[model samples]
Target: MYVAVKGGEKAIANAHALLAQRGRGDAGSERIGYAQVRDQMGVLVARVMAEGSLYDPDLAAKALLQSQGDVLEAVTLMRSYRTTLPRFGVTEALDTAGLASERRVSATFKDIPGGQQLGATFDYTHRLLADELTTPELPTDPLTPPSGDDAMPRVTDLLGVDALIEPDRPDDWTDPDPADLTREPTVFPMSRAERLQALSRGDEGFLLALGYSTQRGYGNNHPFAGEVRVGEVEVEFEAPELGMAIPIGRIELTECQMVNQFVGSADQAPQFTRGYGLVFGRSERKAMSMSLVDRALRAEEFSERRVSPAQDEEFVIAHADNVQAAGFVEHLKLPHYVDFQGELVLIRQLHREFEERVAAARAEGDARAERRTKKEDSHA
Candidate 1:
């Protein structure tokens, strides 16, 4: 079905062969193994996985290696490969409240229920580039975790106790049938679930810019980082044969909940509204930015005036995917000889017409001068 066109087939094959060779840097350098890349370059692989919408670390590592460390290319490779794999079923909604958090912090509160645990974070460090990869001091004994159940309650739970922030879900909530973006053609006015899915897979830099715009009076979202948690949560799935949900495995996830002050609508009483973000792996910054933009897009729901690009749902969701954007932009590299020729022909014709108009105007002015001279001579 995917047979190559006859013209330049050998050239195309050779180009790809050369590209594969170049993936291994300069001569005499040892080739980087997939294991080393998967382990050492875990963060980059996680980002690729997030955008790619796939969870396989090995495939992401291979893609990264093949693409020569290009993130977008790796994501494209992962996305393309995903289409070939068959989907079994969707997983049940994850319970993030029971997450075994390694890093949890609350910017809104001085004291929280579990006490702030600053686990494995670069937030406090003065970011200076290291001149050398110095050996880390090895601990004599393995560090023991605090003796207790690791499942800590979310900060929003505490806020709900005093009725400070609005509940994330209504008391009489039922799971709505969500759309599969991979299959369905996008329709405008997408559901909150769809918007969240798109934004989660969106380019981080794009969302960060939009989120920053909101903070700078574009969307009027003065958001407080209620809580940011990085932890491992169990993923569950319901099997038809089993007839019950079972925990399949655990995945590291980062969640951000933003609290924003909202003026009460005519029907509803005044209360703090919340924005939520959840992403694969330890991506705190992405989670925070996502939460801000997510709330801003809900301007209509909150009955707030939408005044910024971030608040425009269609614009945000449509342009979110980097691969789509790159395809639209990079396609210019292909042959456009006919299109270019058409433009040149039109431009040249327009120039000739302009010159002719100028010449006609000049001739008309000369005739008028001659008529005026003759009239003046007759009067004298």
Candidate 2:
């Protein structure tokens, strides 16, 4: 017997109730609080903050709890909240040169001015956990804590070893005002700012996979993480009223510098060109993936021929975000009966025409057969 599914409203209500139950888990256990989720599940929160483009740790933690630990869903929730928020003012363009760095490492040199600080990393740690985590009464200290440093020299400063690299901005270099992605529609042949803005909110898995493809000899730009730094930077904006640049607020950021070696052309000598990445919050993975992909996209500028999926800016940046890709993909499940019905009608018409042609041919054969039989009967 077919049971009619008549609980659309009731089903939604019941589903919500079930979600609440599942989120709460078994009745007597400690409920997951926002702070607990933020502090304990910081890595997950970082990912959400990176993609969501919001820096609020507490809200991101709440989203993680509400999502039941789905990172992408948590990001989506934060993004939705961000969308509804009113724009108060734009922050000043941050000077990363002045960043109060916690972790700073460069691959180009062995040891530079502001020495290596592997701050708050899971890099050297064994995957196995200690017994304390299972029965923790109080918060434990991380294996590495950030060394508070306000002034740190960039790794690029070390490149002065050779006179080949010059810190000179090209003459007549026009740095145009960046297009606001949230308010403006993205046009073809995107700017660097537009590309980075799109990628900041891009899917981690997709971007990571594309980046991996390039590293696996898909596109032959010799790439390295030249510098990767995580820290806080002051945001500054030009104030016309004050007639001077003013500090707005401090925001935490992760910056990646990928240096790709290019062969000397006839006009220029073989030099190391740069790929830059900056993202909100402490998102090293995202920032690193972004830098790799950014350099890959700039294959033309690097004078390196493009051969990989990562090199295709349109394809990579366009489809990298799950928010956009997921919405379009899942929207297929929504009601499209009208369009389906139209296709059905078109197919039926073609079938009718085909049947008519077959029927006409059969009738012609039957008539010819009858004439032959009459002639044979007359002869007999």
CA shift of 178, model 2, Å: 2.5
**TM-score, predicted candidate 2 vs. hidden true structure:** 0.81
Give every collision pair in model 1.
none
lDDT of 1 by residue, 123-180 (tens): 9978899998575775798443343454456778778888877888878987997778
Judge candidate 2 at residue 325 and give its lDDT.
78
Per-prediction TM-score to the true structure, in the order listed:
0.92, 0.81
Tell me, by TM-score, which candidate is best: 1
| Model 2 agreement with the true structure over 1-380: per-residue lDDT tens digits | 11224676677678789999988899999886899977887777878888887888999999888999887788889889998988756666577876767788887777666667787788887989677767335348544433344346666555635744434245677767766676888787887778988888788888788778878888765777778989888877777788788877787889998877777677777777666788877788878888888878877765667777898888987898787877788788666777999999999999999999999999999999999999999999
lDDT per model vs. reference = 0.86, 0.78
In candidate 1, stretches whose alpha carbon ends up further than 4 angstroms from where it belongs are: 1-7, 138-151, 369-380
